[model samples]
Target: MVAIEFPLPRTTVPPKTGPILPDVLRSEWDKLRTVRSTYWTLFAAAATMIGLSAILCGIYVAQYAHLSAKDRALFDPASFSLTGSFLAQLAIGVLGVLVITSEYGSGMIRSTFAAVPQRLTVLAAKAAVFAAVTLVVTTAASLAAFSVGQMILSSKGIGVGLGAPGVLRTVIGTGLYLAVLGLLALSLGTIIRKTAGAIAAVFGLVLVLPTIAGLLPGSLSSVQKFLPSNAGLALVTGSHAGKTVPSLAPWIGFGVFCLYAVAALAVAGVILVRRDA
Candidate 1:
């Protein structure tokens, strides 16, 4: 029987997608924004930055007359307004560490790796998402802190406007410093893969290392300025040279700080690819 043979339906396989970076980024953003810790940490950072700035500015206004002439002369309203960044860094750093380490702690990382397969893409997405959020939030907090602090300072006739030399740079650099600091913490978290260990490592680099550097012999003490926190702070504080350990130029110091984060992130990517989740 010569039955008309109809061609069998061809099942065409869909073309494989090359890069999933956008999808991965969206996933990472969703994960980050949905977590309770994310909101709490971000709130803590913003609160500390703006609240402490206001408090410090108020104190200075009250104590303005008691200060020595040199103290008054050395008073940098811009730098003083950002004093909260010291504490804010810890909160932001913890958030950064948690961003990756929490997944590892909960064994979600395995699922994440299974889903993405491209480990480097996962890592890059996490860094990019976290960095972007951190920059926006911290920058807004910094601007608020600067504005509030300067308003308080103005009551004492000591406020510097945004147009003042280095005021705008310091305000913006504070955010950049915090964002990069968060990236550094994320890299540490990726490398360590443990929440506590990664946090300790982050704080060690940011806080302890500078202290240790300070204890070096006088000739070696200059090394403090090159450390990550100190280097980043130079930009935020807008200090090139002063009674403190001489700082690198603002941009130079920030560049050195960024290199440290980049180097750590590179190591993290290598280890992430080589190690099992």
Candidate 2:
């Protein structure tokens, strides 16, 4: 009898594996970079910051001789250089909102969630990617603005170097503030899930709340310092000798501002998990 040839059993090798967070981060980064809004918003932010800073510094230089003694004495070159941040924050906020909301608007978030399954991880990944990119871009923009503004102010022999007291901190803090502000907007976008509504909410938080807080009477007005915009701005403004309104210490104010973003993200995470996508 002839024996039948025995077949060899196939050996299966398991696919290589690694940490999930890194994969998620890479995916989120890809998504962020591919979007047209990312380029537009970032360009707008950088341009607004550099352009406005240059223009304002130039104006200050031209009018330096006409300024009052008190005004000149009280001027803060570092803070003034970063004034463009005021408008740049809006652009940053819009980009932040779009980072998530665009996916929601197009129903792509469902696919994203389906792939990740762990909704919080996806949110965290998005935040991580956005914060990293925003921090890099804004910090560069802040440095450029500071340099350009200082160059303009130097024409009048009033410019301070990065070595000056608080100058470096102010430059770095402007970027930090804007980065955190963008995170706040991203958190709001996650919560609202509507591009228009989330953007409006971000604008309201950054712009309207401050104005409303300012309008409050007497002791109530003190609450402004606790608001996210004011608190973050305190870090950028550094420490000034005289002010009609006093702000919290730099790091203290930044901590408060961070708390607001943390709280918003916490809420968004909960809602994302507990509710339908």
Q: Pick the candidate with the highest TM-score.
A: 2
User: 1-277, model 2: which lDDT tens digit per residue?
Assistant: 9776668555586664877898899999999998899999999999999999899999999989999999999999988988899999999999999988998999999999888898899999999999999999999999999999999999998898999998899999988999999999999999998999999999999999999889999999999999999998888885665567758999999999999999999999999899888
Name the regions of candidate 2 deviating beyond 4 angstroms: 1-16
Model 1: how far residue 36 lies from native, Å? 0.7
- Return the number of clashes found in candidate 1: 0
Best by lDDT: 1
lDDT of 1 by residue, 1-277 (tens): 8676569656697766877999899999999999999999999999999999999999999999899988888889988988999999999999999999999999999999889999999999999999999999999999999999999999989998989888889999999999999999999999998999999998998889988898898778888889999998888876522347767788999999999999999999999999988
C-alpha TM-scores of all predictions: 0.93, 0.93
Sequence-dependent TM-score of model 2: 0.93
